[model samples]
Target: MRRRFKLATLTAALCLLLVSLSGCGQSLAQKDILQLDRHSNEITWGVKADTKLFGLMDVRDNQIKGFDVDMAKHITKHILGTKGQAKFIQVTSQSRIPLLKNGNIDAIIATMTITPERAKIVDFSNSYFDAGQSLLVPNGSDIKNVRDLNKPGMTVLGVVGANSVQNIKKYAPKARVLELQDYAQALTSLKAGQGQALTTDNGILYGMAVQNPGFKVVGGTFTKEPYGVAVNKGQRPFVREINKAIKEMQADGEYNALIKKWFGNVPGFNYKELER
Candidate 1:
């Protein structure tokens, strides 16, 4: 009788453990993200709150406003309708991926570039904005282009977790690269003369130049930096919906309108080239 009781207790405990494991698995399973957003009527986005044109924090009401924010709003409407809410969460270059992976945000649209490495962990939608790696320097600095940075003793400023930093190493193998926390810090370091040139996407540099008349983007663009909307690893449905929305926006000239709205006034940047 005693043995039977012990066996029965053990079996029950084992059953409970299996049940708990199954529940946890279900919780972690790939969800239909599109349907989830529709049901909730909201899509939370991780965006940069410091990068000027792509995503910037407007001090007026402490709200983030930029091209990325507007794009996310339009995408939310396409996914969940006009009534759906688009919630923005501020993210830095280092925090965006971790936030997305931990489910803190539904998607990331913070001027993130799609790369073979990033695609392994997070799925990216079709390229929404075409950008390219370039250099931002003081108005009369001698650094004219990437080739000039190839010389020894040149210090290049870059934002941490940015692909631009990685690309710079290829173009300027002899120059030392200093990675800052974000665009704000990088630009500050440049102003303080800590680095010779700040490197990033041209669109972002153009925005910075617009704000700081003393700085300018030079060297044209050495490498393509196509921006994309990122979702979790298994969210193909959500990616497809975003791609569809982009196609619709482009076909109806909404995409071009947004391009003009943000980049039209940027000095020296050919915004028309971006219009689709």
Candidate 2:
């Protein structure tokens, strides 16, 4: 009787262990966002809170608003069948990758440039916005463009962890470089005379120019910085869904409408080709 009881206990314990393992395996396999509406109901997204035009916080409305924000909202609506269901997590360029990797964000809709180097770390959706590197300088400054900054002792301010500093070196090898913490800090340093110019994407520079009339983006783009949405590597289904959403927006005129809403009136920027 004692042996039979022991055998029964062991059998029950083995069954429980198998059930637990099976549950874990199912959870792992069910992680991808195959059904947008259902999954986004439980997921949160990471978006830029600082980037102007692309992403910015609307202090008066107490909501984050911009082109990227609108785009993300639209994507959520299309995928989840509702817009307000998913939550938004504010992210910076330096924090986007880490947050996505740690599973804090379901996806990134910031103005992240797609590059081969970054591709090794995170998966990128199709290019949503085309942009290029450019220079921003104080109004009436003699430095009209990159060519003028090729001389030694010329200082350039760039954000840390961004490829902008490296591109600055390649294009203006003689200029002294100062890396700031973020775009706001870079602008502050530039205004404080820490650097002769600021280097970043033209879209962002344009936004800055609109805000601070004292600064202007000079010269055309020096390097293409195609912006793309990023997800964790191997999340092919999520990437595909985002790409499909972008393509649909482009085809349905929503993409061009967003471009016009943010960039149509910006001086010197031609928004013709961006129209659907």
Candidate 3:
């Protein structure tokens, strides 16, 4: 009888071990996504603090504000309950993904494009916003559209991680491409006459035009750039939560309100096109 009792005790411990392992089978990102409400009820989102309209730091209060800011807060509340807290971390195009991978940030909503190349490493929520590539040039320049940028001497300024330079080459093979550190630098270079034109999403270009009087977005859009919220690869739970929150926002009219709040007043942009 004592031998049988010992065997039963061993079996019980093995069963307990299996149960514990099963509960912890999830990765950190997955576990965090699942216990969003219980585990501190706080989420840190990576966003652009320099890119205007999408996400930028408001100097007055030293807080990041813009379309991405509002969306992150909205989604955080939706997923983690109304009392959920969202901490914002500024990340650039070159650094956002790495930060997400290293567990520094929970998700990326910094106007990032949902490209297949990016998908191999990170999981992206459904396209939350639709955008397109366009050009910003000094007012009255000879370059009127994408077709006019094919000259051999025409230099196009782009940001480091932006795919605009590649698309620009496809659209204007003869044009020279100059990559800068960020959009602000790219715009500064364009204003300094380093490049004939700056290329990025039209929404970003519009923000630049608002800040600089003599530059305008021209050539319409050459490529669709659908913005998405991204999380680490294998974080399907996190991605699904984001997608669900986005749909909820759309159905509840919150998405339209946000679009109207930011893009509504943007000059040369048709905000109606962004309505849900």
lDDT: which candidate is best? 1
TM-scores for every candidate against the unseen true structure: 0.92, 0.85, 0.88
TM for candidate 1 is: 0.92
> Which 10-residue window of candidate 3 scores lowest in summed lDDT?
29-38
Better of 1 and 3 by lDDT: 1
Better of 1 and 3 by TM-score: 1
Candidate 1: list runs displaced more than 4 Å: 1-26
How much is 30 displaced in model 1, in angstroms?
1.7
The C-alpha stretches of model 2 lying farther than 4 A from their native spots are: 1-30, 33-37, 40-43
Ranked candidates (lDDT, high to low)? 1, 3, 2
Better candidate by TM-score, 2 or 3: 3
- lDDT score for residue 260 of model 2: 93
RMSD of 1: 3.5
* RMSD of each predicted structure: 3.5, 6.1, 7.8
Model 1 poorest ten-residue lDDT run: 24-33
151-184 per-residue lDDT for model 3 (tens digits): 8888999988887778998999999999998888
For every model in order, what is the number of clashing pairs?
A: 0, 1, 0
lDDT of 3: 0.89
lDDT per residue for candidate 1 within 176-205, as digits (tens), equals 999999999999999999999999999999
